[model samples]
Target chain A: MALNFLIQLLVNGLIIGLLYGVVAMSFVLIYKSSQVVNFAQGEFLLVGAWACWWLLAKFAIPFYLAFLLTLIFMIIFGILVQIIILKPLIGEPIISIIMVTIGLSIFFQAIMNWMFGVFTEPFPTIFNTESIKIFGLNVQTAYLMSGLISIFIMISFALFFKKSRLGLAMRATAFDQQAAQSLGVSIKQVFAAAWAISAMVSAVAGVVFGIVNGISSGIAFMGIKVFPAVILGGLDSVLGAILGGLAIGLLEHIAHYVDVQFLNVGNLIRIAPFYALIIILMIKPYGFFGTKDIERV
Target chain B: MNLKNSRPCGDFRTSYFKDMSMFEDKKGFFLTCFGVFILSCSPLFLDSYLISLLIYIGFYAIAALGLNILVGFTGQISVGHAVFFGFGAFASAWLNNSFLIPVFFCIPLAAILTAFIGLLFGIPAARVKGLYLAIATLAAQFIMEDFFSRASWFTGGVDGASAEPLKIFGIFFDSDTKYFFIVLFWMVVSFIIATNILRTRDGRAFLAVRDHYLSAEMMGINLMKYRILSFGISSFFAGLGGALYGHYLNFVSIEEFNIQLSITFLAMIIIGGLGSIRGSMMGAAFMVLLPEIMDWLTRSLSGTSIDSALSLSEAIPFIKEASIGLVIILFLIFEPNGLAYRWGQIRAWFKLYPFSY
Candidate 1:
């Protein structure tokens, strides 16, 4: 029984970690390229989940189709947000751009509240299957499928960055905007593309999160949680984001299981990632896999 | 430098008085004093609701002034300022409820504790700058809020803690009119202190570091000392604002001091003009007053029942939040220098009227 509980906890933690990894990737992509930590990345997740639900419920679309449609919508939304709001303010100060994004996040939340009303909605599972027993441990099929899908996405992204033309362009832009622009790389287009890809990634992650925990305004707040992940992994490292997410997930779960007498381990579970974040910041500042040169002083 | 062009007037006494005067000229000084007198007595003629709204404006202005010190003058980005404000409110609330301390004492105590916390956090700030520092501060905000919500002893958990009405000299300040005077008095004191601080050497150091840290450091200024001092002073005033907010509401909650408040404070600084005292007050007043005015207008319109689809309250909240977002965006794109800069230009134009340049 103890072994079974342990397996169950491991499975749950990995699944949660995978979802965080996907969301953290969105943040990592934007931060890696633009050197701007997009605080509204979580809102993209929220919007994606809502869009997926609307597609399924209001339009009676199939699960897979709805997911694809939602991804496309998010990509377009991301690109437009960049072009309309972020692009013109490129030469301006960092605070202006940061505040603009903050404003955009608030605006998006207000719009979402207006459109969806402040009600939590349960997303329909893609595969209507029960928990699968593996070595006397019950694991939900949804968790397994979503976790695998997240891994698949991460692998594909890694491969794309390594080999693809657009990916190289993005890399070039991230390295030096002036050089990229001089080489006729269209820095604006790269930014737009980065935002689009990040938003789509955020959508998928949001759907996974919604499927597991249900959806509400709280889903959008996950963006803030992604901060600890991004910081831990190194703000500019994709693989680091994934590793950081999993580490946070595992740590929080283990902490919860330990159960200290004076403290409510369960309550601390929610803020565990942030606590880890504080410690990491105090020690490393730049994060585990991040470049030391990226450290600002 | 040429003395004639550098000096505003030929007479040494005239130039000295001009620089020494709060408004720089006879006309400007009187206009400002008149504006203050009108603002102070506004609560007498206004309704209770309006007076209460103005009191909130005063509170935000004070908080914004603190933020201006950090972001505007010190050239640091702080997304965690709400945490300091929250700390102040929580500390004061706990003290007021447990020991039954007067609001006056609680306010300063809260400010001092918050300044201490700010100084602690500012240590990391000595090694980091800009966005990295912002992230660290942002982490502090999350940690503080988590502690407030989870640790029930400090913040009374999610349900929030309530406090007794503010009392001065054993007299209860239950009425909005009474609270208005209390807030207004503090606001005036803060303005006076903030203005005077800017004229001092420490204030010049803040501006020096903000404009060019390396140059300031080269000139023998201690970066760590000045940076931390700015943070400490900024947090002190933020605590004052939070304490005042607690007194006004007679209640405090973890939800009240969130990232949203930080964003609103940032928006005020952005809109008001970062380094100027007048800019902070104007930014605070606009942010607080705009929403209240919008809500009032919504109520009046809804009373006539033009839109049957949505309730006024629901619509108002959405509009208020959206407008804040919109205002920040619009201001960033068009008026990044903020309202105070524009006000300065207008005043300059009038002062140099016949010359036109």
Candidate 2:
């Protein structure tokens, strides 16, 4: 019985981990291109999910069409945020940028709460037949779809960075800003694009998460959750972020199992990642794939 | 019309004593004295609500001063300061209630205890700096929060902890009016210590480390020692304020200390003016009053069409939280130097009159 329950958790962990990977990927995209650690990344999820839900519920539109509209809205929304909020802070210190993002997070969170009451609102039932048999476990159709989407998104990202024009420009900008500028890559365009793509991707993750477990202000915790993942994987590595997200997801579930069986110390699932975070920071400030940042002057 | 008192520009120092004086002139000393005198007498005339606001500003400003000493002076960014403040509240309450110590003695004792705990967390700070250090502190915040919830014995568990009011020589300061004096005394002491610390050699070392750690090391300054020392001193101030706060309320709760409170402290230091002690106080005062102003605005607007349409009362908490973010962004964009620099500019405007641009 215990083994079966553990297996079930492992399966569930993989699904949530994939969603975490998608969110962390978007997070790394912003950090690599702009060097701004976005504290409001979860707010991106909150906004996107809320926007999609509003469209579906208010307009009574079909789910696919509403999802498409939400993506479009997120793209424009991300661009405006970059231009208006982050552009003027281009040359500012790291702390200022961090504070601005933190401010943005708080501001947007409160605004979202105000506009949409703090209740958990479910996505208008998208899947007619809910449970699908994956191996032996009964998997929700939304989880399976989300898992596939996350994998598809990862493959596209790999190919885009390798071949696409804008992707190469973004990679160039991330590598060396001055070098990229001299080579004709526009930093401004790259920054706006990074934010737009990030916001759009985060929105998709938000919708997936909402479908799995209804949408509320609580979804914003994913932003904070992203920190342990990103730090574990290394701040700048895209692949590292995905792997780190998976590790944290698995760790949380395992911790939960241990809590139920032995210690019975509640909330270990949430606290374990942070404990892992501190250990990671202490031993390896730079994660598995990240470049060493300490410059000896 | 006296240039000695309101000197807008130029160097007038003739000796080391003149250069290192606390106040610029007799006028500054007298003005400060007069202000404190007025505030000390406020309990007689002001209502309980206004008095409570001043007391709130008192503890917050003390805590902000501690934050500024570490962040503004030493350039160590900490996201886990509220935990230290919470620790102090717990420590002081524990000392008073558990061990049966006097509140007056427990306040300083608690602060000293918090400083030591701060050094333990400051270990990561010794190896890392900037963004990495920020993340490390972020992790510390979560871990400590978990500890607070778990350590029911020390923090009074779910029921929460209660503290004794300040007592000295059989006199109990059990009311807001009496507690006002205790807060005022500590506020003055904290500001003066902060001012004096900046003029000392150790303080200069902190500045040196902040400007260039490499050069500071070359100049025989111990980078790790100063980094850790700044954290200790900062925590000391946080503990002092927390102890006062616990006694004032006569209770300490677990849920009150969180990331939002930490962010609010950051907002206080940023809005007041980074690296300026006076700015910390201004920022704290502004922060304390910001919610009240929002409440007033929302209450007044409730009868208008906007209120009827949106239901203003229900959204008050949201509005207040949003305003803190809005204020931080506005301050960072327009007044990055904070209110201290703005105050200077305003004084210069009047002094220079038509010549001012």
Candidate 3:
């Protein structure tokens, strides 16, 4: 019986971990291109999920159409934020940049709370079958779909960075701004594009997460949770984020299993990643994939 | 760093002793004295409610001043300051309740305890710098928050902990008006200690570290020691401020210290002026009063069409919350130097009223 429960937890961990990877990927995309530690990354999810839900519930539109509109809306929203708020802070000190992003996060989170109310709202029923049996384990259809979508997104991200013309420009920009500028790449467009793509991708993750769990202010916490994953994977590496997410997810579940079986102490799952983060930082600091920076003092 | 810029028109210092004095001149000294005198006497005329707000402003300013020492002076970023502040609160309450330590003495004792914990967390800071350091502190924030919840003996777990009123000899300070004085005493001392520290060799070392770590290292400043020392000192003041805060409320709850509150502390320092001593106080006062002003504004406008349509009463909590972020962003974008710098600019304008220069 205990083994079955542990397997069930493992499956749950894998699904959620994939979703974490999707969010972490978008987070890394922004950090690599723009060099801003977006405190509002979770707000991106909140905004996107809320936008899609509002469209579906208020406009009574079909799920596919609302999802499309939300993506379009997020793209514009992302661009606008980059151009208006972040652009002004380009040459500012690190502290200034950090404060601005934090400010943006608080402002957006509060505004969302006010508009949507603090209640968790469920997404309209899009999937007819609630759960499907796979390998003798019960899995929610939404979880399975989220898992598939996350994989699809990851593959597309790999392709986008490798093959697309804009992706190449972004890579060049991230590599060296002056060299990229000299090579005729516009930094302005690259930044805006990075934010736009990140926002759009996060919206998809947000919508999936909202479908799996009811959408509320609680969903915004994914931004904070991404920290441990990214730190484990390497802050600037896209591939690291995915692996880190899976590891953290499995770690959380295993910790939970231990607590239920022997410790009986609760809330370990919420805090285990932080302990792992501290340990990783102390031992490695650079993580498995992060590039080590050489500073000239 | 240019000493000549801050002095008034004809005030000249002929010796190093004169130059290194806390006040630039007797006039500046007198002005500060006058300001404090007015604040000290405010309790006599102001109501208890107003006095309560002042007490809050006092404690928050003391804490903000500590943050300024770390972020502004030493150039170390911490997102975990609120947890440290919470630790102080819990520590003071526990010391008082467990060992029967006097609340008066518990305040400083709790501060010392928090400084030790700050040093423990500052270990991560010694290894990481900039963004990495910021993330590390964030992890510390979560870890400490969990500790607070799990260790019920210290924080009283979910029930929170109770704190006794401060007593001096046989006098009990429970009222807001009486508590105001204790807060003021601590605030003045904390600011003075900060000012004197900044004027010392150790303080210069902190400035050196912030300006250029490599150069500061070459100049014989121990990079790791100063960074960690700065964290300890910063937490010292954070603990002091938190103790005052807990005793003032007569209770300390785990929920009070979180990421949002930590960000609010960051906002205080940023809005007031990063690295400025007076800016910390000004920023703290501004933050403490911002929500109250919003409440007043909302109350007066409650029956208006826009207010009725938006249901502004229900939105007050959100509006207040949003304003903190708005102010932080606006200040960073438009007034990155903070209100202290702005105040200096205004003073300079008045000093050179007719001249274009």
Candidate 4:
């Protein structure tokens, strides 16, 4: 019975981990190109989820159509945000850039609260099956769908970066901007593409999370929760993001299980990721997949 | 030493002592003194509401001053400063409630305890820098918040802990006017301490690390010590400010110390000026006043030139948030050094009025 429960927890954790990885990908995408740590990444998820939900619930659009529209809208929104707010801040200090993103996050949160009202709403069950017994364990259909979609996106992302022309340009820009610019890569275009792609990814994560859990302002905290995953994977590594997300998700579930079954400690699951993060940072600051930045006098 | 062209032409110093003086001329010194006099006495004529606002501004200034030491002076960014502030609140509340500690004793005791906690958090800084340090501090924030929520006996859990009224000697500081003096006193003390620290060797080490860490280490500076010291100093003020805030509100809750509050503290330091002590104060005042000013402006302009469909009351919070964000973005893009830099420019412009260049 205990072994079965552990297996169930593993399945649950992997699903949540994939969701976190999706958001972490959004974070890493922007960070890779612009060197700007976009604190507003979570707000992208909030906005996308709200847009998708609004279209589906308010306008009575079908789930796929609403989802597609939300993705497209988020892509445009991301590009516009980059062009307007981020472009002008290209050469500023890291702190200033960071503060701007922080400001944008607050702005987005307040705007969302105003638009959506301060309450949680259960997402429409677009999936036909609410739950399915997989190997004698109950699994949420939304979670399974989200996991599969995330895997598909991840695979496509790996391929896109490996094969596409734009992907090559983005990689060059991330590796070294001056060299990339010298090679005729438009830094502006790369930045815009990065933002657009990341926004779309975050939108997918948001919609999936909203469907699996519920849509609310509380969803914005996912960015903070996902930060540990991002750090654990290595800040600049896309592959690291997925692994870190899975690890954190597993850790959280295990912590929860331990707390309930043995220690009876309250809120250990919430603190577990940070505990892992600090220890990991102490042991290897660059993380598993992050490149070490050598400093010299 | 005169690095910028905007510096006033007459500002020439003959000796090291003269160069190191806080004010270049007697005019600046007397002006500051006169300003302080007016500020100290203003509560007499002002309404209680304005006095309360002043108290909040004072505490924010204290917090921002501390933040400036770490971010501006030390070049380390922390997005989770609210955790330290919240820690101080709970610490003071516990000391006051359980131990029957005096108001004066609890404030510093809480600050020291908070600083120690900050130092513990700062351990991650030894291995990380820049954005990495930020994420680590964010971890600190989440961990601290979790502790607050789970430690129900000490922190009162999600329900929150009530702080006893602050009493000094036989006088109870319950009224806004009475509390205004307490906040003002601490704010001034914090400013003086920060000023003194900035003028000392450790302060120069912070500046060196900020300017270039590689060169700072080459100069034989202990990076870990200064980094942890900066965190300690910053959290000390955060805790003191948080404690004062609790007493002012008469209640402390975990909800009050969320990431948004931390961001606001960051916003205060950025909008005011990053490295300047005066900038921290100005930023604090600006942050506290901006919302009130926006509310008033919206009330007057509502349904006139603005949208008729959306109610002004409903839109006020969004407007407040967007404006703050916009202000930070605009300041970062146009004037990265913030309001203090602008103030210096205006002074220089006035000084060289005929030439104007």
Candidate 5:
């Protein structure tokens, strides 16, 4: 029974980890292109989820269609955010840019709260069954679907970055902005594309998360919760993000399990990622996949 | 204006003491004294609500001063300052309640304790730089908030701890009017210390490290020591502010020191002007008053024809938040140096009013 429960927790962790991976990918995409750690990444997810849910529920649109429309809207929204808000802060201090994003996050949260009335809402039911037994263990159907969808998204993203021309340009730019600019990679367009892609990825994460857990302002916290994941995998690496997300996801579940079984404590599961972060930072400052920046100072 | 008191354009100082003095001249001295005179007396004339606002502003100014030291002066960005603030609140609350310590002694004791705790978290400053350090501080925020909220013995769990009314030497500061003066005294002291620190050797070293860590290191400035020292000092101020906040409110809760509060402090420092003592104070005052301004705006608009379409109450929080966000963005883009720079520009313009170029 204990073994089965452990397996179930492992499965649960993988599903949530995948969602975290998508959000972390969005973070890496923006951070890779522009050095700005967009604090609004979670807000992007929240906005996308809300948009999709609003379209589906309010307009009576189909799930897939609403999802696609939300993705497109998110892309435009992301591009506009970059062009309008971030573009002006091109040469500003990193702290200043970070503050802009922090401000943006607060603004986005308030907007969501104002529009959504500070209440959690269930997404229009897409999955037929509530729960499914997989190998004699009960699994949430929505979570399973979300897990599969996230995997599919991750695979496609992996291919897009590996083979696509725009992906190569983004990669080049991330590698060396000035060199890429000299090589005729329009740094401006690359930044726009990066932001667009990042938003789209976060939207997918948001939609899946909303579908599984319901839509709320709490969803935005995932953007922050995923930081440990990005740090674990290496801030700039795509694969690192995925692995880090999975690790954090698994760690959370395991932490909860341990808390329940051994410590009999409640909140330990919630803070597991932060604990993991401090430990990882102490042990490996650059993380598993992050570049070790050698400062002259 | 007296010739000795006024700093006329093109005037040269005859002595080093004249150049290095805190006030530019007697005019500055008189103006500051006038400002303090007004502030001290305002509580008597003002209503309780306005007095309370002043108290909160004073608390924020102290915290913002500390933040300015770490962020603006030392170039160490910390988003988890509210943790220290919260810690201080709980410390003072617990100390006053359990140990029967005087509120006067408890305040500085809480600050010192918070500074030591802050130094522990500042350990990562030696390893992490820039974004990493920010994230590290963020981890500190989440971890500490989690700990404080959960540690029922220390924090009283979610319900939190009640602060004893501040009583120093048989004097009861139970009312906002009384609390206002207490907070004002602390704010003034914090301001004096911040200014004096800037003029001191360690403070200059902080500036040097912030400007160019590599050069400062080459010049034998210990990065680790100063970085940690900066965190300690900043957290000390946060604690002092937090203690004042608790005593004035007569309660301490974990919720009061969440991420939003942290952002608000950052907003105070950023909008007021980074690295400037006066600017941080201005930022604190601006932020403390912002919610009231928003409420006033919302109240005036509530009865408008558009209220039916969009409830004003539902949108007020968003409007306030969005406006603050917009303010930070606008300030960053248009006036990154913040209100302090603008103040200096206006002063310069006035100094050369007729032929201002």
Candidate 6:
């Protein structure tokens, strides 16, 4: 019975971690290429989930079609953000750029609140089937499907970055923007592409997380929550994001369980990832898989 | 001084006494004194609401001064200062309730305790830089807020602690007018200390570190010690502001000091100019007072029926949050040097009047 409970917790952790992994990957992609942490990544996620729900629940579109349309909207929105706001301030200070993103996040959040009207809405799953039992352990159909989808997306992104020309350009830009620009690479276009791809990924994560846990402003806050995951995985490492997400998920689940035995310490579970993030930052400031540069000072 | 290069610029530096003056000139000194005199006497004529608003501004100005020391002079970005403020309020409240200490003593004690905690958090700051240090401070925020909210003993659990009415020299400060005077008095004291600190070696070291850490280090400035001390001093004032705010409101809660407060404080510093002492007062007033004016406009538009304006009020919070975010964005993009630079330009333009290059 204990073993079964542990396995169930592990499965739950993995599913949630995979969701966080998707969000963290979106952040990592933008950071790796632009060296700008998109603080609004979670807001993008919230937008995607709300957009999907509006299409499917309110407009009565099919779930798959709604999903695709949401992805498209997110991509366009991402590109527009890059063009309108970010493109004008390319060589500005990092904090200025960061504040812009934070402002953009607030703007998006306000728009979302105006559109969605501060309510949690249930999103329809693509596969609305019953739970599956694997060796007498029950797993929800939505969880299984979302988990599979997350893995599929992660693997595809890995393969794309390894094989695609655009991906190679992104890598080159991330490595050295001035050098890449000198080598005939259009860094502007690369940044736009990165933003678009990140938005799409955020959309996917948003929809999946909404389906799993419902959607609200709390979901938008997950963007801040995912900071630890991105930092833990190495802000620039895509694979590290995935691994860090899983680790945080497991840690939080265990924290929740462990707190149940103590005196109502469950609230600390929400802060577990940040505590882990601080620890990781103290020990390895650049994170586990990130490249290290000499401190000039 | 060379007459061609430096023409004294009015009465700004006329004599040794004027040069050594805090205002640098007779005109500025008297103008500043007049401003303070007006501010000190404001509560006598203003209504209760305006008096309370001024008190809020005073408290925020003190807190913003602390933040300016960290972000402006020392080049440290703290997104978790609200936690320090909250800790101060909570500590003061706890001491007042449990130990029955006077409000004045409790407030300073709370500031000291919060400073101690700030020092502990500042330890990691020495090793980490940039966003990493920000994350660490953010962790401190979460931990402190969590502890106060969850731990029943310290903070009265989630319900928060009630503050005793403040008393000064046998005079009970129960009215807005009383609170205003108290807050204003401390605001002036805080301003003087903040200004005086800037003229000291430690303050110069902070500016040096901010401008060029390597050069400052090479010049025998200890980065870790100054950085940590900066955090301590900043949090000390933040704690003092929080304590004053609690006493003025006669209550303390977790929501009173949250991440949004920290962000709003940062917005004030950014918009008002990062490194200017005068900017602190202007920034705090702009942030706290502008929102109140907006709220009044909103209330007037809705015909005094809050029930009818529930949706509009719901949008109000989002609007306020968005506006702060927008101000930071617009300022960073256009006026990153802030209001202080504009003030400088205006002063210079007047000083060099009627002369076309």
Q: Report i-RMS for every model.
A: 1.3, 1.4, 1.4, 2.1, 1.4, 2.0
In candidate 2 chain A, what residue range of length 10 has the lowest lDDT sum? A288-297
lDDT of 6 by residue, A1-297 (tens): 656777888888888889888889888999889878687888988988898888888888778788899999999989998888787777776556666787778777877776677878766656656689977889988788779989998999998899999999999999999899999889989999999999999889888888877889778877887888877888889988999888888888777766665556668568888788888888888888877766943
Give TM-scores of chain A for all candidates.
Answer: 0.94, 0.98, 0.98, 0.97, 0.97, 0.95
Q: Which stretches of candidate 2 lie over 4 Å from their true place?
A: B1-8, B354-357
Q: Candidate 6: deviation at residue A53, Å?
A: 1.4
Tens digit of lDDT per residue, candidate 3, span B1-357?
898656555446789999889987778899999998999999989999999899989998989999999999999998889998999999999999999999999999999999998888776688788887888888888988889998999999999999999999899999988899899989989989999999999999999999999999998899999999999999999999999999999899999999998998999999899899999999999999999999999999988998989999999999999999999988888899999999988887887776726
CA lDDT of each candidate? 0.83, 0.90, 0.91, 0.88, 0.89, 0.82
Give the Å error, residue B8, model 5.
3.9
Winner by DockQ: 3
DockQ score of each predicted structure, in the order shown: 0.67, 0.72, 0.78, 0.64, 0.73, 0.58
lDDT value, candidate 5, whole model: 0.89
Q: Which stretches in model 6 have alpha-carbon errors above 4 Å? A: B1-21, B296-314
User: Which window of ten consecutive residues has the lowest lDDT sum in model 1 chain A?
Assistant: A257-266
Per-residue C-alpha lDDT of model 1 across residues A167-194, encoded as one tens digit per residue:
9999898888889889989877888889
The predicted structure with the larger DockQ, 4 or 5, is 5
Off by over 4 Å in 5: B1-6, B10-15
* Candidate maximizing lDDT: 3
**Relative to the unseen true structure, what is the C-alpha lDDT of residue A253 in candidate 2, on a scale of 0 to 100?**
89
- List of chain B TM-scores, one per candidate: 0.89, 0.96, 0.96, 0.95, 0.95, 0.90
In model 3, the Cα lDDT at residue B84 comes to: 88
Q: Per-residue error at B121 for model 2, in Å? A: 0.8
Considering summed lDDT, which 10 consecutive residues are worst modelled in model 4 chain B?
A: B1-10
DockQ of 4: 0.64
Model 2: which docking level applies?
medium
- Per-residue lDDT of candidate 3, residues A1-297 (tens digit): 999999999998998899888899899999999998888899999999999999999999899999999999999999999998999999888888878888998999999999999999999999999999999999999999999999999999999999999999999998898999999999999999999999999999999999999899998889888988999999888899999988888888888999888898888888888889889988877778887777732
